[model samples]
Target: MATIDLTGTDFEQTVNDNEIVLVDFWAEWCGPCKQFAPTYSAVSEKHEDIVFAKVDTEDQQQLAAAASIRSIPTIMAFKDGHLVFNEAGALPPQALESLIEQLKELDVEKALRESGQSE
Candidate 1:
């Protein structure tokens, strides 16, 4: 599926509603963000079952803050309504693909416990 723009209004609901959601926090002026856009888009196209969403940091400062985005290109992955992976910086196409595989195989309950967010 094509990447969608995410806002604070829908962010929580979107994450909750999808089995797996990958959010890209970025700003338009960020060179690395620009460089990473195509890779993100291409990867999103390949993963039809995954929800690929982007939040423009400049325009969504509150949402960015909520996500604790300290970098321009922060990638956050959520599975089963829980955050499973997060990293700053751009990921190469292969790394992005590998991350998808890992997310698919990850045990969400175990990950949430490890992250100290188990409910």
Candidate 2:
């Protein structure tokens, strides 16, 4: 699937609707963010089941603040509407693929229980 541009308006709904969503919080002026765009898009094409969404922080300041984004090229992965992975930095294509593999093998409910997030 091609990456979708997300705004504050539809962000939450999109997450709720998708089983697995990868959100890339980025800005246009950031060199690393620009460099990461193609890599992100390329990976998105390989995963038709995943939602690859991008938020242009410059245009979505409130959303960025809500997500607590402190740096450009921050990537977040959500599974079953719960955040599973979050990190700041541009990942190489191989690393991103590896992360997807781990996420595929991950048990979200068990992870939440182990982390004491499940009540």
Candidate 3:
């Protein structure tokens, strides 16, 4: 799937509607953000089941601030309505792929139990 542009208006609903959402907070001027774009898009195409979304920090400053995005190219992954991964920086292709693989293998129920959160 192609990466969808997310704004403050649709961000919450989009994340809630999708089971697995990968949000990329980025700015066009950031070199690292540009570097990560292809890797992110490539991975998105490979993972049709996941919702790959991008927030242009320059345009969506409110959304980025709400998410506490202090750096460009911040990638956040959410699974089962919980934040599974959040990191700032451009991840290598292999690292991004590994992150997706790890997310796929996660046991949501067990994680909830471990966190002492009842479903």
Candidate 4:
């Protein structure tokens, strides 16, 4: 699972179409983003079940605004077409692995019900 580039046009489809998606919001000029890219890519390679994607904030300003992303290298996880995790800062490889494990444990159906997205 390589990291896919997400643009304004394909943003919704990319997230909604996948059962579990992890998006990294980053910009080319950010040092932290540059440092985090390799870790993100490595994580993607390790996890085949999760769809990993990245959005270039400079090019996708509208998408970034819609996502309420104010910082560089924000990571968001979506499950069942709903946002499950949104956080800023760079995560170590081990931390990212732990996050994936946590996401796997999440009952998305139950979460959707609790969030009033389902009956």
Candidate 5:
């Protein structure tokens, strides 16, 4: 699947509607963001069940702010409506693939319980 462009208006709804969501917070000017875009899209195509969305930091400043994205290539992954992973920087293709596998194998209920977040 192609990466969807996310804005402040649709961000919450998209996250809530998908079982697994991977969001890339990026800007066109950033070298790392440019480098990571293809890897992100490639990973997205491999995982059709997951929603891969990108938010342009320059254009979607408000959405980036809401997500507290301080870096140009911040990657956020949500599983079962809970934020399971967030990191700043670009992940190589292999590492990104590993992350997707990890997210898919995660037991969301157990994770939420361990984090003290009730369902």
Candidate 6:
């Protein structure tokens, strides 16, 4: 499964309503994004449990701005309508895979509650 093209209109519905969503924010002119595309696609194919989406920064400026994406190849993972991970950089296949595996083990709601308590 390659990355799904997400636009401003469908972004909320796709990410919020979905169980787990991994969004890759990128642009055609970005070299690192181009370099990371293949790895992203490969991982998407392997991770059947997650919904992989891509937003073209050039095309979806509104969505990019709303997400506060200042850099290309920003990857974000969302679960249960909450952001679990937000990182800017092009990751190698192995690192991306490892990160996703770690995310799978995390209980986001519990973590959020604990953090809120600490705050």
Candidate 1 accuracy as lDDT: 0.95
CA RMSD per model (angstroms) = 1.4, 0.9, 1.1, 1.3, 0.9, 1.9
Cα TM-score per model:
0.94, 0.96, 0.94, 0.93, 0.96, 0.94
Candidate 3 lDDT over 1-119, as tens digits, reads 99999999999888888888999999989999998999999999999999999999999998999999999899999987788899999999999999999989998779889999857
Best by lDDT: 1
Task: Give residue 92's error in model 3 in angstroms.
Answer: 0.6
Give lDDT: candidate 6, residue 25.
99
Q: lDDT tens digits, residues 1-119, model 2? A: 99999999999999889889999999989999999999999999999999999999999999999999999899999988888899999999999999998888889899889988885
TM-score of 6: 0.94
Better of 3 and 6 by lDDT: 3
* Residue runs of model 1 more than 4 Å from their true location after superposition: 113-117
Clashing pairs in 1: none
Q: Which digits, one per residue and each the tens of the lDDT, describe model 5 over residues 1-119?
A: 99999999999999888999999999999999999999999888988999999999999998888899888799999987789899999999999999999998999999778878866
Specify the poorest-scoring 10-residue window by lDDT in model 4. 110-119
* Worst window of 10 by summed lDDT in candidate 2: 110-119
Clashing pairs in 5: none
lDDT, candidates in the order shown: 0.95, 0.94, 0.92, 0.93, 0.93, 0.91
lDDT of 1 by residue, 56-108 (tens): 99999999999999987999999988887899999999999999999999998
